[model samples]
Target: MILATCVAPLAAFACRFNVRDVGFVDLGSDPYRLYLYVGDSMPMAERESLQSISTATFYDSNVKPQLLPLAQARQSEARAFIPEDFTGGVPAAVLVSPDRKTTLSLPLAKSGVSVLQTAWEALEPIVDSPRRNAILEQVFDSYGVVMIVEGKDVAANTKVRSMVDAAVSETTSKLPGLEKEIQQPPVVAVISTEEMEAERAFLWSLGIREVKEAPRVAILYARGRMIGPVLDGERLNRESISAILDTIGLNCECGLDRKWMQGVMVPLKWDRDRKQQVAKQLGFNPESPEIRIEMSQILAKSGAGQGIHRSKIIGDTLDELLTGYRTKGLAPENPPKQNKKPFAESLEMNKPEASELMLSWVVVAGILILIAGGAIVLFARRRES
Candidate 1:
């Protein structure tokens, strides 16, 4: 029994294949699998090809070269492969193994097309020939395959449909070579919509209009005059409202308001402490008219109505107090410090320079000279004898 167990272990080891043992074939000329290596300094064609894919596509660093060996070992693995062609000016490298495993590495190239093309070329030999029937059969065993699409704006572009279709056609066409190994076409997964919009907005804000689709999220607010839902003239759901607030570093709480039944109006400013206080004071409906009159009276008595208009004083003080309460719950326990500098100190700081004082005296002397000359001329005329 022990010898049998040892033999079984040996058999499993023999069946396993290393990625290095696989061979790569250049099918770059193939119309369906046209491959290109895009680098930071690659050609334009490769970049364009990559752009043809969806704007939502993104590269997965963890799975890039790791999946190449599996692709070469079985034809079914082709379903997991994606074709990328680089057209940028950046340089890149494509490596493949004899067992059909392929590795496409882009050191500095950001183009997704270059990476895909490199991978396609590396596995072209096994995918194109009939001698690799066993591998193809294995690829066909599954109903759906995983394909990676990489690009910066991959999620926003509508062109991804064509790229996906092309990849599916090319991969499925070779299924006949390994009929028993192949199962189904591959499924394409792109970047999430939220991520796409975020990227778009960021790029646009930075003056990058050429960027991909802009993400959009619905915004909704409570139904009231103070706060309601409206985004570019559209209404939003409760969930959307919450999401919008969250994005802008705000929050909302839902509850009944006895003071102002007009449906909880979110103050212009968010005040957690004030909100709680108001919530507790249910049924205590403070009249707006009364509040206004009280505020007017306070202003009239304070003698702060000289150059500072009465209305301005009332508005500023009320707003300050109300906003403070809403945002930070009541005033501080300790009063604020008043400016108490002595008049002498103030005069010393405000004293004019000697040059400025001399200039002022000269202007005064010129005005006096003109006045005296006019008086003298009038007296002479009167004594014209």
Candidate 2:
């Protein structure tokens, strides 16, 4: 596979995606938090000298300054997480909301002391994460298997935690090949139930009460029965986790429905979001079929569009869009409207795509012709001599 390179990094960039290890934690209860760190270790004086007075560590950790490893120091460039243009030097921190949006960036201080705590407090009130929380919950719902660990017993659950992490890494690494075998990527949620005080009652309802011997283990699979793990009597181990992973969410047929791929669900949803954004921009009812159809066609023209095009659903929406655009006077100069649907739908589904055999035959035929020409010349020369 060929990778796209940055031809002119310093000059300009069409796009860039950073796939490094991004430091993330269960948002727990907070809508937003500050992630502060230096690229290299710094003395207390140097840390204190910085403008922001914030601690990057957890609740009970001691306050000291040091550089982080490649994994911990890695930052997210994912959508909503990327900060606006900031040429801030290293050791700078970013304030991220629950949805991974970078709300504020703390550039290194030139002079006077600027505590990170003050910025944290100031940004806390303004940050909100209702939408992000809902989306996260939806992902948890979709996962065929998920391991939930409590915040307090993380250290004790180290062995199992490592197992869970390994499973996740392996599943993700093999996800592309496993699409036909699995409904979704294997996922695990290492959450802080105590930090999420409100969810405690809900956990109890699901029979996962926090007792003294709380193993702090739970497996979630069924959307209908989102049950709590019975840490005591219930068997919670590597075998059980593996069983859950192997059994559920299989595609059954071992065939791909590219026209209706499960992977396109999120991007298809994004198309709706794009439609809504365009409608809001143009003052139209995005929810209306007419307006929605037009926005989808426009969305299919972008990066998100490329994925949407594969499902055939977006491709099917073309005629509707042309009609909608024409009706709204957006398709100027007497736009031609065809009542027929896209031609791709009419093609035979079972027919295999044509291979490169024809090209090979053409090359062979060319060689044969050249050989015959050489032979004719040789025969003529011998006869004449």
Candidate 3:
């Protein structure tokens, strides 16, 4: 009991689930969502389409409608309106509204990932596809501050909105020509301070001097560190905001400020199934030689590109591959015993039944011999007397 009490502090640090955090992303059953099934295997054209669509989901948060992998959609218990045949082929899309009153099954575009945007746009006129606000909470903090301005004053609001817009444009203007080189825009939100009473401490923590009383712009960056000028409402202008935006073009908001409440909010940041299945499809056999060579070729073909994401994904696949190896067919888990022995010795090592029977026979033979010897001894004694 004493030892357990002493070690109790260590228990709090242990992670019990795979998810880091789950942020609120309008998971209401009523919103329209597109369920896309891009299974393990895809032809060259289909694979290109899937990759493009998947990439779009990461970059543009405004691409209306949630993009849940069809496999995950069916498994997600939260979704009560899944159709019976959602388990079909690759490169398929099902668009459905919250009410289930209107549903449409659309053919995927073989042209490329453009299919994702096109598919959503088609549903815009017909259904009310609810979109979550594109405020990436503190995502680009390391790169630079994303000034979230909140106030009722028209002058303050106009000044901050102009500064925010100019900053985004100015920063994006200098990015490299390639799409992959560019990043998603950093988050900048303008809202009423009175409406954000619950976030007073959060605003204050961002270095805002007079949060509720005056026009304040909270600049969050350096992973939650506050910038003094913006919060104090002194340097709320184009030059200052652009200066900050220039440092980091855009940031990945995939896992940014995502939080969860236990098992209810498991992460979809990393797909556990697709990663393993895709690696298998790529013919990733860890047991084979020339692994590095094979991996390079596979990654090039995959079009996932070289980055932390590529490394992480391939690593996950290899881990699953090794796990598959360990659990494969009838391979002896333990080596055979070294010592050779006769059948009798082997039997003795086994259950006691055979040994017990042998002992019984020996005991009966000894009893008979003793009885005969006694009879002969008695006869001799009588004759001698």
Best candidate, lDDT: 3
**Residue 190 C-alpha lDDT in model 3:** 60
Number of the candidate with higher lDDT, 2 or 3: 3
Query: What would the per-residue lDDT of candidate 3 be over residues 83-188, giving only the tens digit for each residue?
Result: 5555545346555443444445555544655554565343332222111012223332123335555666677677667667776665555454211232344456
lDDT of 2 by residue, 1-385 (tens): 0111222322221111000000001112233344554434455565564423333232221112222322345443322332344223344545444344324454433335554334444322222223323433444334434545454555656766776667565445543442232235656665454434334323442344453333455444322122223333245555444433432332212111211111111100123444454345324443466543433333233221111012111222323323333343111122235536546754454333343345445555666777789899999999999
Candidate 1 Cα outliers beyond 4 Å, as residue runs: 1-209, 212-340, 353-355
Best TM-score goes to which candidate? 2
What lDDT score is found at residue 186 in candidate 3? 49
lDDT by residue (1-385, candidate 1, tens digit) is: 4335433532331211110001000111111111223334434564555544311121210012222222232344433333354333443333322223433332423356545455444333212323122222222232222222123455423444454445445444544432122234333333344333323322221122232243222111121111112211122222222222221111000111111112121111113443344323322212235433432332234312211011111122323323333342221122335547898897887686675577667656666776689899999999996
lDDT of 3 at 136: 22
* Model 1 worst lDDT window (10 residues): 17-26
lDDT of 2: 0.36
| Clash count list over all predictions | 52, 8, 6
RMSD of every prediction: 33.7, 20.2, 25.6
